[model samples]
Target: MPGNETTHPLLQRFHEGDPAALGELSDRFSPALMGFAGRLLHEPFLAGDIVQDVYIKLWQRKGEYDSIEGIRKFLFVATRNACINQNEKYRLRQGQPPSSEDADPDEAMRKLILSEYLGLIYQIVAAMPDKLQQVFYLSFEEGLSPEDIAQQLDIPRQTIKNRKVEVYKALREGLKHYKVAMPILLKMLFPH
Candidate 1:
């Protein structure tokens, strides 16, 4: 019962050899993976190849994962490894020594953790109402002040503040399950 509790419908479908399920999983996770790989490798073309390879590897080992979280962990580790391998190869071609700093295990793990947090935040924001989503993006993503957002959206300053409070409440509620992660996220979002 405990084990099955964590089983996702997509994961079950994937285990049954459903190609569409794999595609759906790929669609869900690829953007985050691509962003991670692109930042790690600094080559968009190489990053694309790495993300594709990660999905292929996931499909190849489809039976190994029992939960969506497991699949996500596998994808992150595989993508990171592939990026490191590519960096090593590039270094070899350029006749440069392998950079030790590039292979810091903790750095990769930290990045993976941050990516997961951001992915969860994205999911929460996606489920928000359109007005709240717009306010959140403008205030947080676009770094606009409340006054700026109010001016741009032609709303009152008090209305912008109210919307921001709603956005914060929604985000905090969505993250309530992640007790350990919530504090870190809050600090990052409101470092003031």
Candidate 2:
């Protein structure tokens, strides 16, 4: 980021399947993304997985990011979203999502537009059945192997695998709308 250090134009080439670009973007943003995820998850171990989830999403949808804001916002919003989504799902064992007043930001640069769409995704995830969503979030966002999640949760690993499959299917179906919306939203937002 310094004047002398060469920064790859990762935002440009990443969508084209450039691994080095992906690496560069990860390197550049990892600290901030990690911190954001950590804050949202309120757990260090889980936070690391959340950050990895961001990277995974980025890789899977590199072509989806219309701008740097798309990437940045997506990471932050998704982190918060995953946390809130899980919390809501858990609370529903009783009923209702937790009503935490999200602090207002003073600047747009402090947020990611990608997070907005991701938050929507999280809402969709939360609407899923409790056990299924829990398994999905644990494995998908936290990157726990099905076996590990099962060991930790005292559930069968096969159950975890089945839950993950269901979660992804639901997410793919729900977030399919973003494939069309992200670019259009980006064009409206940045006008570049």
Candidate 3:
């Protein structure tokens, strides 16, 4: 339940041709995909269409993903490409110049991944103890230095630092059940 730990097994089931697994995957990722597509297309209905197309492609290319990570990456990448193609068609239809939105595929993927990552982090942080959650929001969301956070909260700088460490430790432990290594998760969470 914590951080999609079952994604691998679900994906494996999907690879084994279980239709229900595909449905589960769709239910899990459709909201995120819709949001990503909507952001790119600026049209809710078209975004839904794009996500539907992505699912159709997934079914067509069944058994292509060997890992949960691969499937996640593929879905976002395909959705982005589809969005770009849609944008190009719209521009041509309107007789307008194509926008630069799709110029960098890598950047788009990064944004999509980061969006999902932060959403997971937010869920985890929200479930944390109030004090620890405060520390987390101050340090990460508010972009405050430890010392600044300490001053703002009237806590010692050392306590603030300790709370930060505790927060990371809790996150690592909570996320470990999801099979994500701490170092990689930390790097993604705190990319600087």
**Highest lDDT scorer:** 1
List model 1 lDDT by residue over 83-168, tens digit each: 87898788888899886654798876776676566656655766678898788777666678888889999999999889878878
Question: Which digits, one per residue and each the tens of the lDDT, describe model 2 over residues 1-192?
Answer: 233222236666886799998887776566555544543443446767777876887788878776665676676666666765655555666676564434544333233444455455555555678797677556555667777889989988888767766766776677685554544533332231
Candidate No. with top TM-score: 1
How do the residues 59-159 of candidate 3 rate in per-residue lDDT, one tens digit apiece?
A: 78877876666666677778877877897888888899876546988887776665555445554665677798788767665678888888999989999
For model 3, what is the alpha-carbon lDDT of residue 34? Answer: 64
Positional deviation of residue 187's Cα in model 2 after best superposition, in angstroms = 37
lDDT for 70 in candidate 1 is 86
Model 1 stretches with alpha carbons more than 4 Å out: 1-7, 102-192
Task: Please say which candidate is ahead in lDDT: 1 or 2.
Answer: 1
Greater TM-score among 1 and 2 belongs to 1
Q: Lowest lDDT 10-mer window, candidate 3? A: 114-123
- Local lDDT at 92 for model 3: 83
lDDT score, candidate 3, position 42? 40
Q: Enumerate clash totals for all models, in the order shown.
A: 0, 6, 0
